[model samples]
Target: MGVLSICFVSFVILFLISLILFTIGMNFLFNDYTIFIEWELVSLNSSSIVMTFLLDWMSLIFMSFVLLISSLVIYYSSEYMFGDIFINRFIMLVLLFVLSMMLLIISPNLISILLGWDGLGLVSYCLVIYFQNEKSYNAGMLTALSNRIGDVALLLSIAWMLNYGSWNYIFYLQTMSGDLEMSVIGGLVMLAAMTKSAQIPFSSWLPAAMAAPTPVSALVHSSTLVTAGVYLLIRFNILLVDTWAGQFLLVGSGLTMFMAGLGANFEFDLKKIIALSTLSQLGLMMSILSMGFYDLAFFHLLTHALFKALLFMCAGAIIHNMNNFQDIRYMGGLSIHMPFTSSCFNVANFALCGMPFLAGFYSSDLILEVVSQSYINMFSFFLYFFSTGLTVCYSLRLAYYSMTGELHSGALNVLNDEGWVMLRGMMGLLIMSIIGGSLLSWLIFPTPYMICLPSYLKLLTLVVCLLGGFMGYLISSVKLYFFNKSLIYYKLSWFLGSMWFMPYISTYGLISNSLVLGGTVYKSMDQGWSEFIGAQNLYMNLVNMSKYVSSVQNNNLKIYLMFFVFWIIILVSMMIFV
Candidate 1:
């Protein structure tokens, strides 16, 4: 078989394995059974070092979904990266990425989890820089360093867990809930999760990581890397449910959701807009998880993964046909040229907007209702609904720019949805995106949520969604008079468009001052004071002393005689004194 067939074969195998795993996971869920397998490597001082695996419905089902998404991604990449010389390398990296995620999902021990966690950070860095350009390098560095913060936090948590003499945190989560030390660990873990999930201050990297190929973006943003933090918190939900850390996450994630949604509205780059949407959805997941509804968070996570992956694939196809131009302004009337892709794109877009009966609707609608019924402050309530509206606004704005309106690109451009391989990959996710939400809602929840609210409150979600959609259409189709108004208010536009300067705050804003300080320190110490007092000054003194000694040693005849006479006189004087 050809090297390209490797990916196709892998996809088929993974697809079958995913189905089997899903079946097993469903059985486990129905039986409410957990299986733990452990292999002890060493025993010392009544403490044992062991590798532990936990098999329950949650891990198994999550793994199954992960594999399913990964297989489709690999299949898509075969066509997307078809002409590249390093296709095999790309496939291997993707498989490694999947393996790391699998390891993360199954391992119950902190030590083992770290192995997977670090694997994710490292492999993602490699994948981000796969293009080998300055832009890719900078983005890769940002992505790696941002994730490193989370890695350190995870390590700290593991160290703190040593107090309990076991790295299997599942055993201690219940007993350690009220403990001060455990709280500290939980805080560290939360910090780690925030970084991994790109919450608030750490969010810039998520959009920046669009440097990777589209297939990798689909996998990383949708299921593997970004979701790692949410999954970690899901496992540690017992520790976070009623704590200060949980409250902190709630505030941070809510703000993150708002920031990303608003930012997407102002973004022009197609991939980054989707990346921002992923960030927004991640914030939604984290926020609900913080509110102690981890099951809802997990549900949203799965549903989001399905549609978001399909969304990116459609984006990839569009970008491919557009000669790699990612600017949405350069795209219009694509729905006329590429009917199938546009259809899939609209489905994914509406699904993201939580259109009734679609995948996102099942989870996002439920989340809104739950938040509405909860006893949160008015500000939190506003943030929750306002952010939901923003989600719809951006989705519609994206569709308007790309799928509707007059053709914006050059007249000679050609567009078609002809890549059967690419379409086949999208087709799998497309089916899942349509039905995955209701299927998961039915399977995951044994009992339905009882959402009791007044008519106004119950209708609020639909109202906000409608308003958001209307605003999106209006904003995209602004009149020339309003365009002049936008120009007049350019500063406001710039601020909102720039993610409120978060990219600066995370990157240049944080590093520029430190770099200047480093330069000053280098001049004063390494070049100035150190040169005067250290090896340079010592070398000069040694050179002068050596010259004087050499002059004395280079005796002429007259000088030698004078020296001999002086020595004779000194000897006689000493003899007389004796």
Candidate 2:
């Protein structure tokens, strides 16, 4: 422990303080209470811009959760990052990230939100590239640029809000409801949320971001960065309900959820599999929120944050011991060598599958029950249930291959579970994963939802869990020739193993195509044919007209007088004839 460790300790203190404040805020929830702090910046004629902070139960509680995960991540990193030259630098960036999240939580005005939003993007880019390697650099670019799309969308939302004569959108949620301008704002905001949350087209960057340090991934993927969009939707759910935008969300987020789940089943890289799980969980939150269940989405967000952070931490510990090996095929029987991490991993996998009263069960179980009660289309119903089923499928697969299979990482590796600092971090979150659901369910939903789901729907989770477990055992234990299949089958495996080619389309296809098209337009039109027909032709015409004028200007007074005399004679003759 050194100065860097001490700084992490200091941040841990700050997080505790924020948590206490949030706890205190719960007393004011029923009063419809909000605390607003503001300072006027400048006045432009009728409009005055001011910096404002809005503190409510929602913001405070969410901030508390974010801080809690961040503080744990910092503490965990003290050992994970121990003895590194730039450990202090990494800690500082994380602290800055926490600050940005807090700022985002408190802001009421879009301008203030931008301050935090942009801060998150910039700091995330810095953290993702902290390793200073080519892979990290490329991943950082993809992460930053993908998120920039949302930042731009947010800015456009702010621009659109200018038409309403205010930046405080909270006041206009109901007052300006159904206004065309507001619908446009809602659409833009939804687009922004999609990009931030890695829904649909923006999905590639989430898993790619696993190139960052594990602690960073634990914080970013599990809680802060991905959930930011879901949180924004929760805040704006009033405007989203009963809108076409919400339906679009239902579809996009559904596809994202199922896609990520399928991708996780194919992925073998340790961190990336977990990363895809995060993407899938993100999709789940977004999809549920789209159905007008904001509180359920938020509940799952917090609970998911607890277990997923623990999951990443466990993965980090295992990776740390394995000498940076991320392929689970190269790992097995890890529970024998690293019991604590293995236990944490197994518990997280169970919780993720929504087993009984684990943290994930409270929210995910509720999502399934509520979704079953609704009059959803078959497509939505299948996406939701199948995605939920797939969660169990992949999680069971991960647990089987990584924890119980024959050891393939070699016998002389000298792996040990003696990293107490890492184990301490996992212990904190493991307890939460085990019991956080019951506690959060009591706290957030004091009056539990009375679900009227059918018997078949009630059995759906169990059926899925059993089937997923059996399939996982079959896939891992049996010698399937998935690799030696025919070319047709091989192509199908490649398609899914590559995340439905989304990474290719979004990264290489979208970017390369945009650049190539832009270059073509610049050469063939802007610089070539358009130049010939536009500026060049106009310049030539202007020059020829000027030459004719100059030619007519030579000794112009005598010619002008002769013309004037001839016109006067003609006018006089016409007057005489009249």
Candidate 3:
């Protein structure tokens, strides 16, 4: 069969599967938990494999979003990757990746959940390396290796939990407690989460991951692999509730959000900017989820998947026209030529900037309100508030560079609109991004449909968003560079960007000392101690005996066998005597 035939078949299969899952999930959509056991994998007397489904308002909502967006990304890839030799392989991996994420959402067991989790990571890494370029391979290595560190901590925590309680998800919830040590384990698990979610010290790998194709970026950033960490926390919310670890995570998420938003403000590469923005957004979601607002966080994840995927797809179309170049400086005034992509890009960006009536506006507004309700420490308060400013600063920068600036004209025809299939996908997502947020009241929000925040806070958020858009406009108009004269901003960006190097630096120092110590120890053993008379004499006796035996060697197999037989008899007799 042709690649197109196979691709269409795969999409149809996935579409049918998701529709069925979506129906079942929606059927069980209550505010409380409902568990449907597919098969009993383990019991006291026997063990077997089975499938299961668990649903709540949050899981069902996010599952529906994952299935919907993932199906679109798959279809987008078909046309986007047409005529490419590795299209079939890429499709297979993508299908598996989507499958794993869906499985993770509905998993009734932590072990099964993790199986899906690792599968997503593995498949993402594979997709990162799909282009078979050196840079792609290196980025894939860093991304995979960094996530591995987190995965180890997760595995250890799960092992501890399983030993103490049970492996089943509901039973694990029944076993949940706020023990001090369990909080510590929770902290470790959050550490794993921070790494996987690309927070603070573990965040450098995310921008590096821009070497992947645009669809892969869409896949990673949009509600699938990158959001899994936040989903994990939400899945185990029973255990994480009312713990110091939860508090710590709330603070960690705040910091990550601010840092990532700031980083995206000055990024030159279009995808890297989105990548950093994603990190920050995930951080915000983590913070919100940590505060027992799983519904809000998952709703944000849902909207983010829609808008961000739209953003990346439009950006992908731009890059595709530009012969795969991603520099923001080289792209400008593209709205005139590629009207559809440009329109989608602008709508997505507006939604991303949290404009009212758009998806990001509702989700981000909910998060900010949740933060206000949950703030306890002065530190947390400052971080949460400050991150709002950075979020505006960066999201607007993406808008300014791509739509309104002076075009870099050196590369002729390196700028064009995407084909019908790609544009259709972008337009669909754009519409969803605009209207999806308002629907949250009916879908994921715990409260009824109404304006939910205070008037002053709403004003403040609107002012911030407008001010950010204006600031981006001014900066782009003048071609203002933050690092040119601003030493403080430079230092801050450097600090955040280079934070992941600490461990490698420490390892370098330790290895240097260890090598010096090892050499000294070897010298003493070889030159100083062995040079002494008695030690050298003892060593020489063994060496000389081996040398004397060497003189008795013969080329003839018969002679060697005769001597070997004689020694065997003597050795047997000695063994009997002993």
Top candidate on TM-score is: 1
What digit string (tens of lDDT, one per residue) describes model 3 on residues 1-578? Answer: 88868866765666576567556655666435575657665666565656676766556667767767776777777788986998888888887888888788878676787788789779889888888898888678777877887888878877877666555555555455546665555666677777778876677677777877788789789888888888877766766667777777887788788777766765788888888889888988888878777777777888889999998898888888877778988887788778888888888877877877888988887677666555467777667666776667666676677777568757466556637778766766887888888875555544663445677765666676667667766656555555453455766656555433533442344334655788998788766776665678888898999876876674668778888999999999999999
For candidate 3, what is the lDDT? 0.75
- Model 1 misplaced stretches (Cα beyond 4 Å): 41-48, 515-578
Give the clashing residue pairs of candidate 3, or none: none
TM-score of each: 0.90, 0.87, 0.83
Q: What is the Å distance of residue 32 in model 2 from its true position?
A: 4.4
Candidate 1 structure quality by residue, lDDT tens digits, 1-578:
66569989999998999999999999999999999999888999988778899999999999999999999999999899999989999999999999999999999998899999999999999999999999999899889878888999999988899899888998988888979667998898899999999998898899999999999999998899999999999999987887899999999999999989988988999999999999999999999999999999999999999999999999999999999999999999999999999999999999999999899999999999999899898877888899999999999989988988877988877899899999999999999989999999999997998889999999999999999998888878765337576678889978888877888887787655666788999999999999999989999999999997887689778778888999999999999999
Q: Compose the digit string of candidate 2's lDDT tens values, residues 1-578.
A: 78555756765796687579667667555566888998888999988778999888788778878877887888889899886889888888988998888888888888888888889999999999999999998889888988989999999999989987889888888865578557888888899899999999898998888888999999998778888888888888877788889999999999988998888888899999998888888889988898889989989998999999999999999889888899998888888878878999999989998999899999998898888889799999889888887788888888888888667986667788898877887888899899989988887777779987779888887887788677666666656546655345878878887888999998798866876899999999999998899999999999999997886788789788987999999999999999
Per-candidate Cα RMSD to the true structure, in Å, reads 4.2, 6.8, 6.4
Question: Considering TM-score, which of the candidate structures 1 and 3 is the better prediction for this target?
Answer: 1
In model 2, residue pairs whose N, Cα or C atoms come closer than 3 Å (at least 3 residues apart or on different chains), thus clashing, are: none
> How accurate locally is residue 429 in candidate 2, as Cα lDDT from 0 to 100?
86
Off by over 4 Å in 2: 30-32, 41-48, 479-488, 515-578
On lDDT, the stronger of 1 and 3 is 1
